[model samples]
Target chain A: MSRGDWASWLESWRQQLVLWLESTPAGDFVNTYTWAWPIAESFHFVGLCLLLGTVGLFDLRLLGFARQIPLPQLHRLIPWGIAGFSINAATGSLFMAAAPFQYLYNESFYFKATFLSVAGVNVAVFYLLFYRKIVPLGAGEQAPWPARIIGGVSLLMWIGVMCAGRLLTFYRPSFRFF
Target chain B: MDPVFIWLEQTALSVWVRESPSMFAFPGILTLHTIGMAFLVGLTSAFSLRILGFARRVPAPEMLKLVPVVWFGFFLNLVSGFLLLLAYPTKALTNPVFYLKLTTIALALLAVRALGRRVADLSFRPVRGWPGDRVLASLTLGFWVVSVTAGRFLAYTHSRLLASDF
Candidate 1:
C-alpha cells in the first residue's frame, strides 16, 4: 500500500483499538475511582526515581565516573531499577487503559515508545555483545570502548524516554489529526 | 502572600509559562522537573542501598562520587520547580500537599547529607552492618518516597488552578 493508505489504515486501527481498550475491566476501575489515577501517577514518579537512580548510576560507572566501585557489585542495584520499570509499566498501562485514545493517537506517546524501544535494544546490545568482556574489570579500571559507548547510548535513551514521557499529556490526540 | 501570588502570576514570565502554546513553556519545565526527580531520587536510593548492604563490595566512599550527580539533579529541580510555581503560584501555594512535598524534600536532602558524611568518614571500611548509617539511609529512602507521592498529588489536590479561578 502507498504511504497515505498505510497512514489512514493505522489511524483506523488505532480508533478501533481505543474503543476496545475503553471497554476493558482495567479501564472501568481506573475511570471510576476519583483517586486511582492520581495514585497510580504517584507510584509512577516514585518508580521513575528508582529506575533512574539504579540504572543511571550503573551507566555513570560504565563511563568511568565512579572508578572505585566494582562493576559486578554496582550491578546489584539493577533489580531495583527493574522494580521501578515494573511499577512504571503497570501505572503506564493504567493510564493508557483509562483513556486509550489519548495515548493511542498522541505523537508524544510515539516518541516515548520509540525511546523505550531504543533503551531495550541498548540493553540487549550490552548483555549480548559486551557483558562477558566487560564483567571482569575491577574497580578504578576504564571500561572497554564498546562498554563506554553502550553506557553513553543508554544514558541518552533513558533521558529521551523521560522527556517523551513528560510530553505525553501535552500531545493528547484530539481525533482531528486522524 | 495572596497579593504576592497574584502579583507573581501576572508577570510576563509567569503568564508565558501558563499561557504559551509552545511545548517549550510549561511542558518543557515539567519534563525537566521529572528528569531531575529521577536522578535526584534514583542516585540517592543507590547510596541508601549500599548503606543497607545490598552491594557490600562497593567501597562506601566511592559512592560519594555520585553526590555531585545528586546535587545536579537537585539544582535542576529547584530551577524547574520554581518556574512551575511561577506559572501557577496559587495552585501550588494553596495546596497543602505542595508544602508537604517541600518538607519531605528538605528532610530527604538532610538525610542525604547525613549519609554522605558517614560515607565520607568511613576509612574505606565495609559498610555492611552500621546500624546508625543504615537508619539514615532508610530514612532518606522513605522521605524520597513521600516527596514523590506528595509532589504527584499536587496536581490532583490543588484547590485552585489560578488566583481568580477559585
Candidate 2:
C-alpha cells in the first residue's frame, strides 16, 4: 500500500480504538480501576525483566559464552520468560484500552509494537527450528549454526523492542504535531 | 526528613529536572531509567538463574563474569533513579508503593550480592548434587523478578506529587 493508504488505514484503526475507549464510562470503577494503570505498568516492566533475563542468557550462551551450561538446562528459563511476556501482554492491553488513541496515533508506539511483533515472531521461529535438535543434546554440545543464527536474531529483535519502547515517549506523533 | 525533602526540592538539579521545558529533561530521564531497568534487572535475573543451576553446562563461576554487565546496568539505573527521586522527593517518600519498591530492590540486591560471593568462591567446574544451591539460585532469581514488579507499581500508587503545599 502507498504511504497515504497506510496512513488512512491506521487512522481508521485509531478512530475505532478511540471510540471503544470512550464508550466506557469515565467514572466507572473499571475505568479508574483504583491504581490499576500503575500496577499494570509495573507488571509490564517486571515482565520485561523476566522475559529479557531468561532469553538473553540463552542467547548469550548461543553466542558461546558460558559454554559449560547445557542448552536444555538453560532453556529451562524459557518458561519464566514466556510467563513474563504473558504479563506484559496483559498489562499492555489494559494501557491500550485505557488510552487507545494516544498510543494508536503515536509513531513511537507504532515502532514499539512493530518491534515487539518482530521479537515474538523471532522467538517462535527459534523454537520451531531449533528446539527439537537442541533439547536432547548432551551438556557442552555446541549449538548448531541455525540455533546460533536464531539466537543472534532473537537478541537483536529484543534489543530493538527495548530501544523502541524506550523511545516511545520521545517520538509520539500527536494530532497537533501532524 | 521533611526539611531534607524541602531542601532537595529546591536543589538546582531537582528544579531543572522538574521544571525544565525540554522534554529531554524529565521524560528522557524517565526513559533512561526504564531502559536501565530492563538491562539491569534482565541481566541480573539471568545470572541469578544460572547460579541456581538452571544452566548446568554454563559454569556457575563463569556466569559471575556477566556480573559486571549487570552492574553496569544497575549503575545506570541508580543514577537515573536518583535523578527521578531528586526531582520529586515527596512524591516517592510519601508513597507506600515507593517504599515497597525500595524494599523489594534492597532484598533483590542483597540476594544477588550474597549469591555472587558464593559463585565467585566456586571453581569453574559444576558443584554437582547440591539441591540447596539450586534453591538459593531460584530464590535469588525470584527476588529480582518481584523487585522489578514492585518498582513498576510505585508509579501507580504514589499519593503525593510534590513537596510543597502549592
Candidate 3:
C-alpha cells in the first residue's frame, strides 16, 4: 500500500480499537481507583530494572564486555528478565486499556511500539541463528560476530523503547477523554 | 517562596529545563535518568544476586568487570538527576521522599562497594564464608527497592510543582 493509504488505514483502525477499549471494565478500574495507576507505574519501573539488569547484562556479556562470566551460566538470570517483561506487559496493557486513544493516536506511542517490535525481533533472531553457536562458549571467549550484532541491536532497541515510552505523555494527539 | 528556590527557578538553565518547549530539555533528561536507573540498579542487583549465591557457577570476581558500566550509569544519573532537580527546585527540595531516595541510594552504593571488595578478596577458589556477603547483598537489594520506591513517590508526594505554585 501507498504511505498515505497505510496511514489512513491505521487511523481508522485506531479509532475503532480505542472505542472498544473505552468500554472495558479494566479501564474503569484504573480510572476509579486513585492509587491503582501510581502503584502499577511503580511496578513498571521495578520491572524495567529487572529486565535491564538481567537481560541487558547478558547482552553486554555477549558483546565481550564481561569475559569471565560464562554465557550459559549467566543465561540462568534470563528467566527473571522474562518475569520483568511479563510485569511490564501486564502493566502496560492496563495503561493502554485505561485510555486507548491516548496511546493509539500518540506519535511517541508509535515509536515505542516500533522499538518494542524491533527488540522482539532481535531476540527471535538471536535464538534462531546464534543461540546454539554461542551457548557452549566458555568464560573469557568472545561471542561470534552475529551474536554481538544481536546484543548491540537489543540494547539500542530497548533504549529506544524507553525513550519513546517516556515521551508518551508529551505526544498525546487528542484532548478528548474517550 | 523560598529565596533559593525562587532564584533557582528563575535561573536560565533551570528555566530552560522547566519551561522550554524543546523535547530535548525535560523529556530527554528524564529519559536518561530512567535508563541510568535501570543500569545502576539492575547491574547492582544482578551482582548482588550472584554474591548471594544465585548463580553459583559464575565466577564472582569476574562479575566485577561490570563495575565500570555500573559507574557509567551512576554518573549518567547524577548529571540527569541534577538537571531534573534544577528544573523543579521547589518540588524536589521540599519533599521528604526526595531525601529518603538519596539516602537509600547512598546506602545501597556503600553495600555494593563493600560487596565488591569482598568479591575481589576471593582467590579463584571455591567460594566460602559467604554468610556475611549474603547479608550485605540482601541489604543492598533492600536499599535499592526503597530507593526506587522513594524516587517514584516523589512525583505524587511533592506538595508543589514549582515555587510559584505553592
Say which candidate scores most in TM-score.
1
Q: Taking the tens digit of each residue's C-alpha lDDT, what string does model 3 give over B15-83?
A: 899888999999889999999999999999988887776767888788888989999999999999999
Model 1, clash count?
Answer: 1
> Which pairs of residues clash in candidate 2, taking residues 3 or more apart in a chain or in different chains?
A42-B152, A68-B57, A68-B58, A69-B57, A69-B58, A70-B57
A-chain TM-score, model 2: 0.85
Candidate 1 on A100-147: residue-level lDDT in tens? 878887888999999999889999999999888767878887778988
Per-candidate Cα RMSD to the true structure, in Å, reads 1.7, 4.1, 2.0
Instruction: Give the clash total for candidate 3.
Output: 0
TM-score, candidate number 1 = 0.96
Q: Per-residue lDDT of B1-166 in model 1, one digit per residue for the tens?
A: 7788889988999999889999989999999999989889989888888889987888878888888888899999999999999999999998999999999999999987987887787664765738888898899999999999999888888988777442
Fnat of candidates, each listed? 0.95, 0.70, 0.71
Q: Which of candidates 1 and 2 is the stronger one according to TM-score?
A: 1
lDDT of 1 at A23: 84
Residue B59, model 3: Cα distance from true site in angstroms: 0.8
lDDT of 2 at A70: 77
Docking class of 3: medium
Q: Which pairs, if any, clash in model 1? A: A53-B42
CAPRI quality band, candidate 2: medium
Docking class of 1: high
Error of 2 at B142 (Å): 5.1
Candidate 1: Cα lDDT at A55: 86
